[model samples]
Target: MPQPVIYTHQLTRKFGDFVAVDAITFEVQPGEIFGFLGANGAGKTTAMRILCGLLSPTSGQANVAGFDVYRQNEEIKKQIGYMSQKFSLYENLTVRENIQFFGGIYGLSRQELKDKTNVLIDRLGLHNEANKLVGALPLGWKQKISFSVAILHRPKIVFLDEPTGGVDPITRRQFWDMIYEAAHDGITVFVTTHYMDEAEYCDRVSIMVDGAIAALDTPAGLKKQFNATNMDEVFLQLARGAKRGD
Candidate 1:
């Protein structure tokens, strides 16, 4: 059987009287792309933060890459990579410079960094733009570079928070292809997105509403269970059910 890369049991987070995530339980298997779906303020980010060891859960347990999030945060950090919704590259730096900077921070040697940079630049088709300033690159290119930098350390799990936000449809598709390639190479991807079409690309998906998981299944399973033709309908129905306190 495949081992779980992420496991959470009744994981909850609270801020004062407001609960950000409420007793959420789930597991993501190795090499799977697990999509986390939710409306804004639906606790998706909060849950992801906890899983990434950026924040502590208020209660329950979370194990990432076989390390307890609360007790082995440092180990967890080393095993996971995170790409936020916002592109997080230095706009003033060139593409190669950005790669070098990130790789250095991850303790990579100069020779190793140079080799990886060359491979990445070629793989991402950024050979011609390697010397171009990141700020001058198109939004799609910047996003792609940011994603590449995030995984520079070759982490076991990569968490992406809306990694493909405002790009064109073609760019979005390309980004997903990159994600699939990463997963195929044995990296587990956990992501959050509002795009139903993108959600369908995931091997499994979990929908959050009002700080709890309202639905969890493969895309086909969700569609069948909700008797919906698509993920959007399933999401809408689940969201409405949550609002009605059902």
Candidate 2:
């Protein structure tokens, strides 16, 4: 078996006296699409923050891309990419400019940037709109552009925080196509979403409730385990007992 790309054991986080993440453990393999699901205040965000090196855990062991979460956060950051639902692009920057800026931040060489920028523009079908400000583009186009840029550096893992939110079903489908391509190219995708249909698309899912993982399995496995017909039913079977969302 391959070493897990993301691993955690008894990982916990707290806010003063309140436990925000409670002894969660999991492993993600390279190129896997890991779905992190939770209701509001279910500690999903807090756990992801710790794994992404944005925050420290109160206790437990974790390694992201072979770097210790407690000691090698800077290195962990280098091995990962992050994208949120908002797309995270500068509204005023032109499409081409945004691509160059983020690629440069990832330390792509000047020549590499020039080459990649052209490829990104071509792949996104943005040739006509490459010079337009990102804010001027439609929401769907912006979403695609944002995802393309997030992985432009080819990081080992990309943490997607509700990457498909607010877009139409068609656009969501298109966004997921990009996600599959990323995974196909060996990028481990860590994603969180409220869409049950989207949950069905995950390689495996871990659903959180009250700061701990309530269920973890392949969608089919989960359906059989819960005796539910779909992810929505499975999620509801667990989420109905959530105490944090109230």
Write down the lDDT of every candidate, Cα atoms only.
0.91, 0.94
Whole-structure CA lDDT of model 1: 0.91
Judging by lDDT against the true structure, name the best candidate: 2
Error of 2 at 85 (Å): 1.5
Regions more than 4 Å wrong, model 1:
244-246
**Which stretches in model 2 have alpha-carbon errors above 4 Å?**
none
- lDDT of model 2 at position 149: 92
Candidate 2 versus the native: TM-score? 0.98
Worst 10 residues of 2 by lDDT: 237-246
In the range 1-246, model 2's lDDT, one tens digit per residue, is 999999999999999999999999999999999999988889999999999998999999999999999999999988999999755899999999999999999889999999999999999888999999999998888889999999999999999999888888899999999999999999999999999999999999999999999999999999999999999999999999998763
TM-scores of all predicted structures: 0.96, 0.98
Name the top TM-score candidate: 2
Residue lDDT tens for model 1, 139-172:
8888889988988889999999999989999999
